[model samples]
Each structure stands twice: as structure tokens, then as C-alpha cells.
Target chain A: MPCKFCSEKPVIQLPNSERKLCKSCFIKYFERKAIRTINKYKLIEENDHVVIAVSGGKDSLSLLHLLKKYCQKRNNKIKLSVLQIDEGIKDYRDISIEDTKKFCKSFGIKLHIASYEKETGKTLDKIKKQHKKTIACSMCGVLRRYLLNKYSRKLKATKLATGHNLDDEAQSIIMNQFRHNIALSARLGPITGVKKDPRFIPRIKPFYFLTEKEVATYAYLHNLISKFNECPYCEESNRFFIRDMLNDVEAKYPGTKHSIVASFIEVLPLLKKKYKNQEINSCRLCKEPTSSEICSACKVKEKIKS
Target chain B: MPKIYLEKEDKILEVKELLVSDILKSLKINPTTVLITKNNELILDDVKLSKEDRISIIPVISGG
Candidate 1:
């Protein structure tokens, strides 16, 4: 079959759109969709310092590559930097950090790496050892998010960009619904955080509309170096289950993932409106934005210390 | 015959025209865990491939 847009030989058939596209057309379509999402959401503005979170994984690396290409092609004045969090997982993080550094060096982007051992004095390995009841992913998730926001804010970044794609976003939405966390569900979107502050950098997802499959294909086609290894400490969290379940549903019913994200986007404004007035205060320990006197990171630190 | 190149393994398999899903099945690989590309472009599972096509299958797993 020929490409839907051009007469060139078709290469891909989009699951949702069912539009067949050739190599160059597919690349253009992918980049254009991402830029469209950014513009539609006003994710970034002129002269914005965008700090991207890179994990040396396909998604994040793809985000970094695409964002750089986007800026160059459009002559965007936005500055891009990379922030990598070393969770101190012995082999898993060490290898990826090296890959991240190499990619950053090749791209000529500045990279800032924050290790849990330095900031919290406890690596994820140690935390997992001490807190046997807690999941490694839970601990890593909180610390990674806290460090990303803290470092981005310290760098005076106007926005933080993450590698979250359609699959991740849809899984998060379904997981939140399963957990019955409406407030958290309110926080899910292309751009996160309902109440924004100067100290808190808003995160933008450039791959918000693309799926994991699409992002992986783009990364591979671009020959981006990414470690496909799963973390040794990663357990089957509810998210894993949700991810598998959603993938199954998507396979059985094409466009289900897109619909899930679309419905969430449609209702996001109302969710934000409903939760907009929630009070936020500074954490006494870190002085970061939090609803309570003490933040989740502080609480986790206390657990590790005690 | 169409040839599928496994990028990570640096191996290639020659096969007849087949749907991407069927090709994956013949290789005993899970469809969800890999990305199929033809002539350096992504190919969906439903897309049919011809003998002249050069395909690459790259294993991809999900993480945050």
C-alpha cells in the first residue's frame, strides 16, 4: 500500500488513525504531532529553560532527541538541559547513567545528575533494605519526582519535560481510578500540577499523545542508545498489572488507549476546576510546596533515618 | 522473500509476505515487546509486508 499523504511506499499503519505513511512522512508526522501537542497545551514559551528528565531509557532519550530536533527545526529559542537521577541501584542505574552521559555529550546538552546517596544519604538499595514492607518502585518514584522538581527549581527552569507517553498516562489514569484516588486523577494530564508556583516547575510531556510502541520505534529508527534492561528491584506493582491489562485491551480493541487519554483530557478541566482551591503550603523541612507542614520526601527520610 | 532484521541480535530472517503479527508469531516473539520497522520506518501489526521490504525488529520494554 502507498502512503496516505504522499505517493511514496507506505511503511507504517497507525493503529488509531489507520493512516499509512512512508519513512520521511512518518517522521514528519510524529514530530508534528508532538509539536502540536506542545503548542495546543502551551507547554513551553519563548526563552523558556526546559529541563528534561532523562533516564537513558527509550522514552526519555526519545524526548530529549525530539525536543532538540524540534527546537533546531523551528528555531525555537528555548534552552534544553538534562536531569538524571541516580537511584544508586548497583548495576541498573550505573549503566544507564553512562548511556545518559554519552547521549548528552553527543547532543551537546548539559546534564545534571543527582544521586540519592548525596541528597538523602540513603540510596534506593538501602531504603529497600530497611523498609522491606515498602515497594522499591514506590520509594524510587517519590525520590525521583522530588529530586527532579527540586533540581529543576534550583536551576531556575521555567518548565520540566518528562518522557511520559500515552501508555503511561492512560495507565496512570486507570490506576488512579482503580485506587479510587480522585484527587490524584485530577493531577494527570500532558502538563502536570494544578496549582503552579514559582518554586515548583511544571512538567510537560511531549510524547503525551504518542504510545510506547511509537516512541520506541522512533528511538530505534533514530539509532538512539537506550538501555532496555528492567530494574532488578522493580516489583510487579499495580501499575504493572494496569499496563498489561491496558495493553491487552488495546490489542483487542484498537484505539482504546487513545480513547482513554481523550476522555481524561476532556474531563481534566473539570477535575482541575474542582481541585483548584486545594490549599498548598511550604514544607517545614525542605521549604518545597506541599499541602502539609512536612512533605512526603521528608517523611520518607525520617523513616530511613529512624 | 522479505527479510526481517533483528537489530539487537544482528540476525536476519527471510520469510514470505506476512502480516507483522504473523511474522512475530512465527518468530515466537511477543507482539507487545518489540517494534517492527520496514525500510527504517515503523510498521503496525496489521500492515502487510512484501518480499522486497527490508524490516527490522527491535526489542523494547516499558519503564517510567
Candidate 2:
């Protein structure tokens, strides 16, 4: 099919919609949707310092590329930097970090790298070896998130942007529903965190409405990413199963993923309101914001050390 | 025969002429998780293949 806007050959047929767009038209649509999402949610503001959490993956790199383009196009006085957590997985993370560095350098965006070993005293590979009973992703997620927030706060960033897209959000909503984790579900949205403390940096998803395919296509078109690398520890997590299952259903049902996110967005405010009054505490070891005295990262660290 | 290249697996398969969707189905790959390119160009799922066609399946999903 020709592009919906022009006679050029089409590049992608947007899921859950009848419109197909060619290379140039699709780029415009993809960027426009992100700008609209950012403006609608007030994810970024003037003079705000935005720190992007990048993994050297398509989603993160695409977000980085789009934000740079967005800021330049509008001439917005937004300070942008990049933060990448080195989970210290051999072969997996090292290769991606190199690509991320090149990408950031191309745009002159300052890139900061943190490591699990330096901060937590062990690499993720070592932790996985010692804690055979625990899920690697869970452990990595906690530590990565902890470090992201910790460093973003240190950078004095007003917003932390992630490459989270519609598929990620849909999988998260379903995962939360499956586990009956309403409190965690409350934190799922385009812009995350319920009551932000000075220590906690609010997270935003600029690609909230786009699908993984669309993001991948955009990244490919712009040559923003080097390769598609799946984290070595990812396949063992609950998310991997849910992602495959969701993809299976989506193939058959077409718009299933979009519907999940759309419905979740409608109910997200109610979910957030229900849990807004929850208490936040500082971890005795690290003094980071958490629901309990000790944070999840600290808990994982103790597990590894024990 | 049509040839299918799986980028993630770094493997290739020789298959019968079929629609892109059916080829993915035979390989047990969810169409949602991949993009198909025909003769070095992107194509939609409904596109049919000929014996001379060379298709590449590029996986898009990356677990974060």
C-alpha cells in the first residue's frame, strides 16, 4: 500500500489503525506523537534539566534522538544529559554502552555511566551467580531504578525520561493486574511517581503512545541505534513471558495492546489517588525514598552480600 | 524457493512461496515482535512471496 499521505512506498502499517505511512511521513508522525504526549502531560518545561535513562537500545536511543530534535526545533532552553546504568553483564551491556556513547557524542549530550559493581560492590553477573534463587531482572530492576533516581537527583534533573512505549506500558499494566499489585499499578503512566519528593525524580515516557515496532522503525530510519540487543538476563523474567504472550495475542487481536494501555490510562488517575497517601521513608543504609525503612536495592544488596 | 533470514537467530530457511504472515506462523514467530523486509525493503504482513523472493525478519522487541 502507498503511504496514506503521499505516493511513496509505505514503511509501516500502524497497529490498530488503518493508516500506513512511508519513511518520511512516518518519521513526522512518530515525532509529532511524542511532542504531543510531552506537551499534553507537561512532561518537560522551560529551563528544566532532563536526564534520559538510556540502555543503548532502540527505544531509549530513539527517545534521545527525538528529544534532541524536539528541543532544537522549538529552541527550548532544556538541558539534556544521559544516564546509563552498567548492569555489568559481560558482552551484553558493554557493547551497548559503546554504541550509547557514540550516539550521545554525535549530539554532544553529556553521558554519565554508573555501574552496579562500583555502587553496590558487585556486578550483576556475580549477583546472579550467588543468588540463584532470585530473578535477575527483579534484582537488576531495583538496583537500576535506585541508581537512576539517585543519580538523576544528584544531577538536579527535573524530569527523567525513559524509552518506555505502549507495549511496555501494556505489559506492565497486565503484569500488575496478574499479580494484584495495585500499588505498583498506581505508579504506571506516561509520567510516573505519585507524590514526588526532592530525592525522587519524576519519570516521563515520551514514546508513550508509539508501539515497539514504530519505535524500532524510527530508530532504523534515522540510524540512531547500532544493534538490537536483548539483555542477557531478560528472558528469565516474568516480563519476557508476558511480552511473548502479549505479542501472541496482539497478532491475533490486532489492537489488544493499545486497548490495554488506553484503558489503564483512563483508570490510572483513580489508581494513583487510591495510593497517594502511602507513606514514604528513607532507607537506613542509603537514605533513599522507599515505602519501608530499607529500599529494594538495599534489600537486594543484602541478599547478594549474605 | 523463497528464503527467510531470521536476524535474531542469525539463521536462514528455504521455504515455499507464502504470505509473510504464514511464513512467520510456520516459524512460530509472532508477527508483532518482528518486521519483515522483502528484497531489502520493508513490507506489510499481507504481502505474498514468490519463489525468487528473499525476506528478512528483523526482531524489534528488546526487553528493558
Candidate 3:
């Protein structure tokens, strides 16, 4: 099929619609969609320092590239930086970081690298070897998020951007529903967290509505990433199952993920309002904002130590 | 037969000519989770495979 807007051969079919878009047209559509999400949510404002959290994956690299393009076309007031958390997985992060470094160099952006080994005194691989009963994603998610927020704040960033897409958000919504975790759901959205705290750097998802396939296509077309490598520890997480389930549903019913996110966005305000009054406390160990006395990252560190 | 390269497994399969959708179905890979490329260029799901086609199935899902 030809592109919906042009005569060129279509490169991708929009997950929510029958419309197919060629490379050039899809790139514009993708960027415009992200811009709309940003503007509608006020994700980035003038004079704001935006630190993009990159994982050297397609989603992150595409986001970093998109923001670079957006910054070029918009006001010069918004500052851009890149942050990468090295979970210290052998053969996985090592390979992907090379891609990220090349991308940052080509784009002329400085890249900040933080590591679990540096801050927590143990690599994820070592921690996983020792804590055989603990899930890798559980520990990695907590520490990666901790470092992202901690370093973003240290960088004096006003907003931290991530590469999360519609599919990811949809998976989280379903995962939260399955686990009966409503408060976590409240923290899930384009702009995360129910309310702002001084130490918490607001995180934004520019590709909030775009599908994973769309981001992959964009990354492939631009060669933003050198390879498509899945984490060695992915299949152990609940998210992998949720991701497959959501993908199956999306295949059977087009726009299933989109519908999930759209509906969630509609009720997000209420979810926030309901959970906003909940007090935010600083983790006594790390001093990071958390709902409990000790943050999840510190807890994981304690487990590793034991 | 069309040659299909599975990016995740780093394996190639020589399979019967079929539509892009059928190829994914045969492999049990959801279309939403991957992209099909022909000769290093992206192709639509409706495209039919030909004997000369060298296709690559790129997995889009990344867990971190």
C-alpha cells in the first residue's frame, strides 16, 4: 500500500488506524505526535534543562534523536543532556553502550554514565549470582530508577525524559491491574508521580502514544542503534509476560494498547487526585523521595550486602 | 523459498513463500512485537514473500 499522505511505498501501518506511512511521512508523523504529547502535557518548558535517560536501545536512541531534532527547531532555552545507567550486565550493556557513545558523539551531546557497581558496590551480575531468589528486573528497576532520578537531580535537570512508549505504558497498566497495585498505577503516565517533591526530578515520556514498532522502525531507518539486543534477564520479569499478552491482544484487536492508554489518560487525573494526598517521605538510607522510610534501591543494596 | 533471519536468535530459516503475516504466524512471533525487512528495507505486513527475498525479522521489545 502507498503512504496515506504520499505516493511512496508505505513503511509502517499505524497500530491504531489503517493508515500506512512511508519513511519520510512516518518520521514527520512520529515527531509531531511526540511534540503534541509534550505540548499537551507541558513536559518541556523554556529554560528547562532536560536530561534524557537513555538505555542505548531503540526506544531511547530514537527519543534522544527526536529531542535533538525538536530542540533544533524550537527555542534555544531548553538544555539537553544524556544519562545512561550501566546495570553492569556482561556482553549486553557493554555492546549497547558503544552504540550510545557513537550516537552521542555524532549528535554532539555529552553522555553521563552511572553504574550499579560504582554506587552500590556490586554489579547486577554479581548481585544476581548471590541473590538467586530475587528477580533481576525487580532489583535492576529499582536501582536504575534511583540512579536516573538521583543523577538527573545532580545534573540540575528540570525534567528527565525517558523512551517509554504506548506499548510499555499499556503493559504497566495491565501489570498493575493484575497485581492489584493502584498506587503504582497512579505513578504511571506521560509525566510520572502523583505530586512533585523537591528532590524528585520529573520524568517525561515524549513517545508516550507511539507504538514500539513505530519507534523501532524510526530507529532502523535512521540507524540510530547499531543492533537490536534483548536483555539476557528479560524473560524472568513479569513484564515480559505482560508484553507478550498485550502484543497478542493488539494483534487480534488493533489499537488495544492505544485504547488502554487513552482510557487510562482519561482517568489519570482522578488517580492522581486520589493518591496525591498520600505523603511522600525521604528514604532514611538514601534520602531519596519514597512512600516508605527506606527506598527500594537501598533495600536491594541491603539484600546484596547480606 | 524465502530466507528469514531472526534477529534475536541470530538464526536464519528457509521457508515457503508466504505473506508477511503468515511468516510471523508460523514463527509464533506477534506482528506487534517485530518489524519485517526485505533487503534491509522495511516492508508492510501485507507484502508477499518471493523466492529471492532476504527478510529479517527485527524484535522491537527491549526490557530494562
Candidate 4:
């Protein structure tokens, strides 16, 4: 089929829109859609310092490239920096760091690499060994999120951007629903649904509308060098199951993921209203925003130390 | 023969003209876990390959 936008042959058919596009046109369409999402959500503003949380993976590399393109094309005075957390997994993160460095250098963006060992005095490998009962992903996720927020704030970033695409968002929504965690579901959006606080940098997802397939295709089309290695510690997570199930459904019904996100968006205002008065406390140990006296990261740190 | 560049293994394979899915099946690779590209352009499963094409199979990886 010919590309709907150009004379070139179509290479892809977007799931939600079913619009067939060729290679170059697909790239343009992907970037333009991301820009629209950013504008629609007011994700960025003038002179905003945006810190991207990159994992040296396809989604993040594509996000960084697209955001850079957006800034250049629109002449937006936004400073972009990269923050990568080293989970200290053997062979996994070690290799990804090289891809991260190469991309950051090529893009001329500043990168700050933080490690779990530095932040919590224990690498994931050591933590997994010591705390055999603890889920690796659960521990890694809490620590990575804490470090990303802490470092982004330290770098004076006005906003923290992540590479979460439509698939991730949809899976998260379904996962939260399956777990019956409405409060957590309330926190999912283009921008975080949390109340504004000085200590917390608002997290934004520029690729919130694009599917994982689209993001991967974009990365490949751009010839971005990225590590496709799965983290050694991630195999046992429930998210893997959720991801595969969603992908299966999406394969049969192409726009199912989009519908999940769209349904969440429709009810988001109500969810926000329901959770608007929820109280947020500061962790007694780290003084970070949390729901209890001690934050998850601090709690994990205590476990690791013991 | 079309050359298939396996990005995960950093190796290339010579194969005959077939649907992208068949090529992956013959190689015992799961289509869901990896993406196929030809000349740097993504190729869907049903797409037919040609002898002149250079394909790349890239693994899909992301953090939750």
C-alpha cells in the first residue's frame, strides 16, 4: 500500500489510527504525534529544564531524540539533560551504559549516572543475594524512582521525562485495576497526578500516546544505537505477564491498548477528584514525599543494611 | 539470498525469499519479542522478502 501522506510505499499501519505510512513519513508522523501530546498536556513550557530518565533502551533513546528534535524545530528554550541509574546488574546495565554514553555524546546532552550502590550502599546484585525474599524489580523500581527524582531536582530540572509509551501506560492501568489500587491508578497520566510539591519534580511522558511497536520502529528507523538486553533481574516480575497478555490482545485487536488508555483518560478527572484530598507525608529519614513516615526506598535501604 | 542481521547476536544469516514471519519461524525466533527491519525500515509479519533485501531482527527491551 502507498503511504497515505506520500507517494512512497507504506511500511507500517498505526494501530489506533490505522494510517499507513512509509519510512520517512512514519518517522515524521511519530514525532508530530509526540509533539501534539506534549502540547495537549502542556508537558513543557518556556525555559523549562527537562531531565530525561534514559535506560539506554529503545524507548528512551527514541524519546531523547524526539524531544531534541522538538526543541530544535520549535526553538523552545528548554535545556535537556539525561539521568541514568545504574542498577548494578552484571552484564546488563554495564553494556547499556556504553550505549547511553555514546548517544548522549552524539546528541551533545549532559548525562548524570547514579548508582544504587552510591545511593543506598548496595548494588542490585548484592541486594538480591542478601534479600532473597524481596522481589528484584520491586526493589530496583523504588530505588530507581527515588534516585531519578532526587537527581533531577539536584540538576535543577523543572520536569522529569520518561519514555513510557502507550503500551506501558495501558498495562499499568490494567495492572492497577487488577490489583484494585485506584489511588495508584489516579497517579497515571501524561503528567503525574500527584499534588505539586517542591521536593517532587513532576514526571512527564512525551510518548504517552505512541505504542511500544511505534517507539521501537521509530528507534530502528532513526538508526539509534540502543541496548535490547533484558535486565537479568526482571524476568520474575508480574509486569512481564501483563505485557505479554496485552500484546496478545493488541495483536488480535490492534487498538485495544489505545482504548485502555483512552478509557483511563475519560475517567481521570473523576479519579483525580476522588483522590484530591489524599494526604502526602514526608519520609522521616529522607524527607522525601511519601504516604508514610518512611518511604519505600528508605525501608528497602534498612532491609539491605540489616 | 537475503541477509538477516540479527541485532541481538550481532550475526547475519542468509535465507531465501519468504514472509517475514516464516523467516523468523525458520530461525526459531519469537516474532513478539523482536522486531524485523529491512534496509532500516520496519517490516510487518506478512510482508514478503526479496533476495535483494537486507533485514535486521532487533530485540524489544524496555523497563517497567
Taking all chains together, each candidate's TM-score versus the true structure is 0.88, 0.97, 0.97, 0.91
RMSD of 4: 2.5
lDDT of 3 by residue, B1-64 (tens): 8899998789999888578888887888888888888878999879997787889988888745
> Model 2, B1-64: lDDT tens per residue?
8899988888899987588888877888887788888866788888888888889898998845
Clashing pairs in model 3? none
Compared with the true structure, the alpha-carbon lDDT of candidate 2 equals: 0.89
Q: DockQ (C-alpha) of model 4?
A: 0.41
> How much of the true A–B contact set does each candidate keep?
0.37, 0.76, 0.83, 0.37
Interface RMSD of each: 3.3, 1.5, 1.2, 2.9
Judged by DockQ cut-offs, is candidate 4 incorrect, acceptable, medium or high?
A: acceptable
What ordering of candidates by TM-score runs from best to worst?
A: 3, 2, 4, 1
lDDT of 3 by residue, A1-306 (tens): 799998899999988788999999999998899999999999999889999999999899999999998888876568999999999999999888888888899999999999999998988889888888888997888989999999999999999999999989999999999999989999989999899887889999999999898888899999864666778887789898888888888888887888899999999999999999998898998788889999988888888996
Model 3's chain B yields a TM-score of 0.90
lDDT at position A277, candidate 2: 97
The best candidate by TM-score is 3
Give candidate 4 regions above 4 Å deviation: B1-17, B21-33, B50-54
lDDT of 2 at A188: 80
TM-score of chain B only, all predictions?
0.85, 0.89, 0.90, 0.87
lDDT of 1 by residue, A214-266 (tens): 78777777887453577876554768778878877877788898999999999
lDDT of 4 by residue, A115-181 (tens): 9989888888988898888888877778988999999999999999999999889989999999999
What DockQ do the predictions score, one after another? 0.35, 0.72, 0.79, 0.41
Candidate 3 overall lDDT versus native: 0.89
